[model samples]
Target: SLTKTSGTSSRSTSQLGRHFHHRTPGNFLDPEVRAFLEENTEVISSGNLTPEIRLRLLTPRCRFWKERADLWPFADPFWAIYWPGGQALSRYILDNPNIVRMGSVLDLGSGCGATAIAAVMSGASHVLANDIDPIAGMAMVINCELNNVNPFPIAIKNITDTKLDKWDLIVLGDMFYDEHLADCLHHWLGKCIKMYGTKVLIGDPGRPQFTGHSIHRQLHKVIEYSLPEPTRRENNGLTSSIVWSYQP
Candidate 1:
């Protein structure tokens, strides 16, 4: 059975009332985080990939700084944007349902849970959408609701020590933005494949740090899409991206 973190799922209807609840005395859990995203972003279909589902995203006019000042610097709303890499992977899964259907799936660094939602929609038996950022987790929960899909478990922590054996398929979306992060994922994902037979898939917008020889040797492009200018600017002007199946 797929390992699950009990009671932490943001899917429960009961938790909807506590969206603005206080996690600490002075540190409220961005009570307005979901509302801010809904207000600022427009709901639209994902780029070529699962265009049937709606995603809440930031447009060029919506400034990230428009949010509360206290939440500034720490609040990275990238999850609110749909990147090319994620769109590619999601599209691939939809086109190839057997790859995830009836299997346990994990969406690592699952910002906004777009890939995770795709996995679930494709008939995955169980799914875990994990992100170290709590804000991102909130975005995932809300996004799931917008898409009218059941929210998967959202793990808000570094998942290096996770029970790898529990997952059959792992989907990583646009996580190779930094060299250190790229190196860590390269080593850890390789170990997951070697130790267990975990199938690893990745979506990248051609990052400089993503030079993993092992992955590149077996990497085959799955799909590609032309990202809008605003989205391109966010990704350093990279207009297109590829989804690849890692044969480690």
Candidate 2:
């Protein structure tokens, strides 16, 4: 029942099928995926980010358990839940539309495409939402369509894997979860700055990787927010977030 991509193994295909119900190369335009998104997520006005625009997002019932790879399709729906970091960035973009006006924007780790969609709404000339997970990419597309934004593309891979020379602005949201990733981001973003003069912005909810010694050292805080609460009780206490300008 699983369909295979060009280089993917049979096992990987089976797992992807389980997530997209056997639709190989499933994209945001897939009718099945659109229906699934409609059933799994709720379309609502962003409570804290940009209350003016409605987005399709996950609620508490989605069970976003990020550690369980086996439950990747259902339980670990990171793309569904609107993290505090994303909320902060989305709000910042909306409130300061001029920041992205007429610019080319890239939203790395673009969960549900909130920031990318916000960038489009903010009058960016071009927007790309990139995520490591294929499901997240599809989710971004679906969210963009739900928000009535068009021409926004989703890339399912690491930002470093792509050619970033053409991009004018880079936005990262809640991506500083792991040490290795933070390290990689630090080096890659530094190169992006020196080589391309790309303006970088980051949104985080005080993730461990965004510590005082890590990415935080290079970030200048721009704005703070009381974002929407996570569904999980343990993650509930952390309601504050910050938007930072990356001086890489």
- Cα lDDT tens digits, model 1, 138-186, are 6777778887888788787778776555579899877776656666778
Q: In model 1, where is the ten-residue run with the lowest total lDDT?
A: 1-10
lDDT of 1: 0.70
Q: How does residue 190 of candidate 1 score in lDDT?
A: 84
Residue 199 of model 1 has an lDDT of 88
TM-scores of all candidate predictions against the true structure: 0.78, 0.82
Looking at model 2, residue 39 earns an lDDT score of 71
Which 10 consecutive positions of candidate 2 have the poorest summed lDDT?
Answer: 1-10
lDDT of 2 by residue, 77-152 (tens): 5666677788788889999999999999989888778899899999999998887666676777666667788848
Best by TM-score: 2
Q: Of the candidates shown, which would achieve the greatest lDDT relative to the real structure?
A: 2
